[model samples]
Target: MRKNTVGTAVTLCAAALLTAGLGTASAAPATSPAAAHGAQAQRQPRQPVLVDCAFQPQARPDAFILACGDGNSRLASLHWQHWDGRTAVARGVNLVNDCKPYCAAGKFHSYPVVVRLAHPEPWKKRPQVRQFTQLSLTFTGARPAGYDRVVTLPLWS
Candidate 1:
């Protein structure tokens, strides 16, 4: 009877160890699902989208028309003269309307403009622009004496 009691105690102890091992293994698999989700998130990075001013004029001021009339002010053409990934120089035309009396009877005007695109620094405080933060427009040729030569517009309204 003494030998039988000792054997029963050893068997119980072995069963407890086996159960504990199985529990650890099952828990490891459960944790792997969460780990896989984390890996997937890390694999996907945020992609930057290029600005299209025709659709979002206020968002992309660099390519927007001045003095909009009946939503007719738009970027007619853009010829990229120089681009080095970070900065770009382009020549474009802003088809705007000179609202002499009002928008209903406004005349369309084509303005030649120089476009410059610059990447924004992390410390800049432009909440309206995303991706590229600095967009400057300089009107080519002659302009009004008091008119500004360079106009920096927000990427967003």
Candidate 2:
């Protein structure tokens, strides 16, 4: 019985390898722009060169936006910036109840689209710069208030 099992395992392994090789050999050429760049060979997704801002309710900052996917909302501050020279800003308004429909908070609200803003210029700390470059929002309210998360556009890596 043991020998039979071993033989079966070897056969399975050989079949798997053969199938893999054949699959690759028979596959058509990549047609996407990414494929043209030979990136498919490495099996990596094209990372967007833009900043993303959202609130994480589990990581902390109970009422604010957090960077990484944590539940807490307080730490929900502007955490990352991309190469698109865009940063995100919170709508600035806080929801009276996290349960409100479209509220930044939702039931199981595991993933709520928080506030995000982007600036075209490199994110530079200057007390004088005003007017954001580009703005996109997934927020609870229209008025930017106390619990919103806002960040400057990323000019750096």
For every model shown, the clashing-pair count is 2, 33
The deviation in Å at residue 7 for candidate 1 is 71
Worst 10 residues of 1 by lDDT: 121-130
Top-scoring candidate (TM-score):
1
TM agreement with the true structure for every prediction: 0.48, 0.23
Per-residue alpha-carbon lDDT of model 1 for 72-152, expressed as tens digits?
566657777765536667788866666668866988777788877777333223333334456687889653344488877
The alpha-carbon lDDT assigned to residue 3 of candidate 2 equals: 100
Candidate 2 lDDT, tens digit per residue, 1-157? 9999999999999999999999998896758896666855333222222322431111112244333244433223333333222343332332233444643554432223344544444323332222234434454334333434433322222
lDDT of 1 at 74: 62
Candidate 2 lDDT score relative to the true structure: 0.39
Off by over 4 Å in 2: 1-36, 40-70, 74-114, 120-138, 142-157
